[model samples]
Target: MHRFLIPKELKILVETARRSCLKKPDLFRRGGYHRDLQEIRWLLDNVESWNAESRISSVSAYSILEAIVLFFDCLPDSLFPSQLYSTIMDASKSFKNSLEIYNCLPEINANVFVYLITFLKLVHSHSSENDTDLPLFADTFADVLIKPPAALSLSQIPKSDRDSKRKFLGYFLANDVSHLFQIDLLLTRDEYPLLARHLVRTGTN
Candidate 1:
């Protein structure tokens, strides 16, 4: 198991993003901004035997990737391209181990979905701002394409039973699932233009 340390660079990025979001209250709801900031703080303050290894694990890797994507999305377009690409590449490579780790923690599926959605948003935003072609790797939905069997299996569960059990679990766990949908919606809106253009251009080719 690879030990995961919170890199100083990531810490700085999270803090900077949090500060930027906080400064622009009009751009995002207060509650959303606070939630984002709190998530970062939790990541920073928490210490567990798994903290180091979590980045390599599929379940935890998604959470880490989602946080990074969110932070990166808030950054100025003028930021160093090479640095951003290097960071994303590292995260993508690490996520390759997510399948093994995911087997150990089935409940983290929602987090994985959210992370992929966030990643899509990041790539779309990058393409839009740079007026450049979208990276091919960004074309597929990683969570859906890479883990469809797992997702389909989950979807096979009876809706009534699933809802009943989820209701009993109350707001906290329910909110986690809802967050995935929220992230999905955000990504859909963010990437629609790029996706449309890509589809049109690809069809012609």
Candidate 2:
């Protein structure tokens, strides 16, 4: 239930799908079609054994993407954190200000956010080759990244508010995150020590 640090399950899901999503143009954009609740739950329960078993390997990229989205959706606070909702959704907020806002996130949250956004940016860079649409990605991820304060319900969000939030996500997709983060996509090596620690699944975790 803690909303600060991301869990191992999420890292596993994203890492597992990283290659396929990047290489298969459709996988990153379309994600996967099998967003079944049962599958997501099954993934959550069994992600610990991912390296030891082939079960998770058989799951579609769509299900992996769905499980990742569901994980954030169920967090005590959404990825952007409720306290910054208004500031983040402000349409007039400058691109510089958005980078500042990202710095405001807790260390772990910021790292993970940068990590995920960096991946999204990479996928977007291949948009022409991958055929992924940024607007749709923005719309779908808006609810996941930003939302009404904890006191409010998603059902209560107005259309204008929704649009603003989606636009906010689009900014991250459009910009380079290296200004605020140190991200190396090739996590297979030992460089970028700080990020390498977060990307890998440790026995102690």
Compare the candidates by TM-score and give the number of the best one. Answer: 2
TM-score of each: 0.21, 0.71
Error of 1 at 96 (Å): 21
Regions more than 4 Å wrong, model 2: 1-6, 23-44, 47-54, 153-156, 183-205
Model 2 residue 152 distance off true place after TM-score fit, in angstroms? 3.3
Overall lDDT per candidate, in order of appearance: 0.30, 0.59
Scanning candidate 2 in windows of ten residues, the lowest lDDT window is 196-205
Over 23-52, each residue of candidate 1 has an lDDT whose tens digit, in order, gives 221221112233434444354445342352
Worst 10 residues of 1 by lDDT: 196-205
Q: What is the lDDT of residue 30 in candidate 2?
A: 49
Clashes per candidate, residues 3 or more apart or on different chains: 3, 1
Model 2: pairs clashing at backbone N, Cα or C within 3 Å: 32-62
Question: After superposing candidate 1, which stretches have Cα over 4 Å from the reference?
Answer: 1-105, 131-205
